[model samples]
Target: MNFKTKLLAYHAIAAAIAVIPMQSMASDVEIKYEKFPLTSPEAQQIWAAESNDATPLGEEKPWAMIAKVKVPGKKDLVVSQLFSSMHCGGIECPIKIMQEGLVISEGMACDAYEYHELSDDHEALMACDAIIPLDLK
Candidate 1:
């Protein structure tokens, strides 16, 4: 083959090799968890059931505090605390960590939470402050 022809063929082969990885990486899909607002009926129903009530109590139903959370290398989660209900009062409200309409963790007390910078690719779920472990085991 001529010098120019060989050079052109080498470049073409290198370009094809580079494109392979990019194509494979593009095919990798990450499933994101669905988000629900605090006032949404879906969120309210979940909390109500967790609180052992058929429906939320008081005029202000869905009194739970909800926060969208994302941890590193983890699926998105919704953290909720029923701050006002017959089963709970004051800072003793129960904490629930949920994802995809399923409760991952619950029955922990949370006075509040510390949210990190979610906009800058930081972990959205930081720490649940003032949490007292209910299970002694």
Candidate 2:
């Protein structure tokens, strides 16, 4: 190829490489605590413990699944929250909802706390099509 054509080809390849990563990143969803306005005292406490240096925030365990249930014409969306245990003990280790940043739901075992009452039932949990284990540490 002539110099101009060769230069144009190199530019096209470079542009493609740059565009590909951005597209991949756009498709990827990252769950972070800050995304949801979880400001309750219990949530705050959990957040603090997670940040502490001495806390034993172990590797994320596969706790729950998220499924994109089909609803006509609307965007394909998955239920945002999934089950996660921080590996802490007692009250600290209760199942948490990682998406939306707040604990929208918890296991029935956490019924002692009023907020945990918002948790989903077994049928709801089973409906999820995808499971992602959370790594709290």
Candidate 3:
């Protein structure tokens, strides 16, 4: 085919592809997790790496805090974020660790967790593979 004919064919194919939506690609995949209550007993006993009983959090390894987040507009819908270790920045928000212009758990892997939100406990269904020991202390 001539150069002009080839150019027209290429342009037509490009326009057709642009009009079609790619079903494989997701449009929205945003997930948010807020810090869980540290005062709760479950928060004190972390689910990540083990730390010595004598060594207080932040003294040795960073302290991992779980997040209790509920799906918007759904009172009964909730999920937990088993976040990596992060220091408590202050008393008001003891679990809010962004401080001193530094993040203790920076470059850490906070997985997209899936679990059964219970009234008094949580049951893990599936989660990111990065969860060490597949959810353990």
Candidate 4:
């Protein structure tokens, strides 16, 4: 084979090897929620109560929801994940870390508790450990 052709082939193979693991490492997080459409009025109320300073931004309405999930062996674990359109009314919202109902560390933003809105590249359901609507009924 010509030297030019051989060089091109080597580059292509090297590129393929480098790309494959990055694709694998970019794994999709699997999230399971208790219900779809979260239609319960009670559930909506609970979410509203949890939302910290969630007021509508322009025409965009603020919202929240509660999620009941079973993670592997941990059955029926209820963890509240909140959403807000506004930034905590410019207040430093304390992020609580709890284990079995007792706060292990307070005011530390648990990586799991960090909030992000839904987007095309990322699913809100997947981004959050669990999802709660920002509004209550």
Candidate 5:
């Protein structure tokens, strides 16, 4: 082919690539959390230590779940939180973030939580009931 035609074809290819999204061009990673019932003896121990037995009837067990978080190029994270009909009252409950069975973070309250891997840093987003979302680093 002539130089002019080859140059035009190269320019067209470059233009198409430039318009494509950066994410689609790279390996796409899905970030999400999965909840599984907390039924292990270890989980029970954690609940007993943190629950404080606030409920009027001590017999009322706190509903709990372990959240497994998946992040790109990282080990799965384990989160412990109370849920269902029996959770700590108001906006706060005991929350724990763990990796490899080791606690990385512990907090009093977070009805909802999310982790973000930003361009230059990482952060956790937490929201309490009836309260504004907090951007935590």
Candidate 6:
């Protein structure tokens, strides 16, 4: 209750705040492509779900996932993709990936994040998904 004690307490609180990480509700997600035969079990599962029919450009690299969908109460849906390579195009590239099947718990990166996802894309979640072209205009 003295000035000195109060100052020390404030400093301790500030230090604790600095060390603690900030948590927020994450909505969007993305990941980049990596070589297949992934080592992690999670990664392997994701890769297995990929479409075999995608084009080289789609299959080769830049795999991604870009879904904002979530099944309330249940965990958020998992998305993965490579739609362009599967030969679908237009606005948004029509990338797809396995969902629910690729289901991930809240608060984690998608498998495609291994590749690189500065922004969200649908490549990591599109395995076995139907390819539908969208209009850009």
Alpha carbon lDDT of each predicted model: 0.51, 0.33, 0.32, 0.36, 0.50, 0.38
Error of 1 at 128 (Å): 6.2
Q: What is the lDDT of residue 98 in candidate 3?
A: 23
User: Which portions of model 4 show Cα errors greater than 4 Å?
Assistant: 1-30, 33-52, 88-137
lDDT tens string, model 6, 3-78? Answer: 9999999999997775452211121443334333223354445554444544455355434344434433333443
Clashing pairs for predicted structure model 4, backbone only: 44-136, 63-133, 63-134, 63-135, 64-132, 64-133, 64-134, 64-135, 65-132, 65-133
Task: Give one digit per residue, the lDDT tens place, for model 1 in 5-82.
Answer: 999999999999976743433212221334444456856666655544523445655465666654555566666666
Of the pair 1 and 2, which is ahead by lDDT? Answer: 1
Top lDDT prediction, candidate number = 1
Better of 1 and 5 by TM-score: 5
Estimate, for each residue in 22-124, the C-alpha lDDT of model 5 and write its tens digit.
3233222332444433445656644656455434224544555566655455676665666433455564666666667666666665545443212212234
Give lDDT tens digits, candidate 4, residues 1-137: 99999999999999999767444432233333233122246335444334445655346454333344333333333333333435333322223222354333333122343342222222112233322221111
> Over the stretch 1-137, how does candidate 3's per-residue lDDT look in tens digits?
99999999999999778545322222222224444443344544443232222234444333334443332332222223333234222221122212122222222233433321222121122222221111111
The C-alpha RMSD in Å for every predicted model, in order, reads 16.2, 14.5, 13.5, 10.9, 12.6, 13.7
TM-scores, each model vs. reference = 0.45, 0.22, 0.23, 0.33, 0.47, 0.29
Report the candidate with higher TM-score, 4 versus 5: 5
Ranking by lDDT: 1, 5, 6, 4, 2, 3
Better model by TM-score: candidate 2 vs candidate 6:
6
List candidate 3 segments past 4 Å from native.
1-31, 36-40, 45-49, 53-61, 68-137
Between candidates 1 and 5, which one is better according to lDDT? 1
lDDT score, candidate 6 = 0.38
lDDT of 1 at 69: 53
Better of 1 and 4 by lDDT: 1
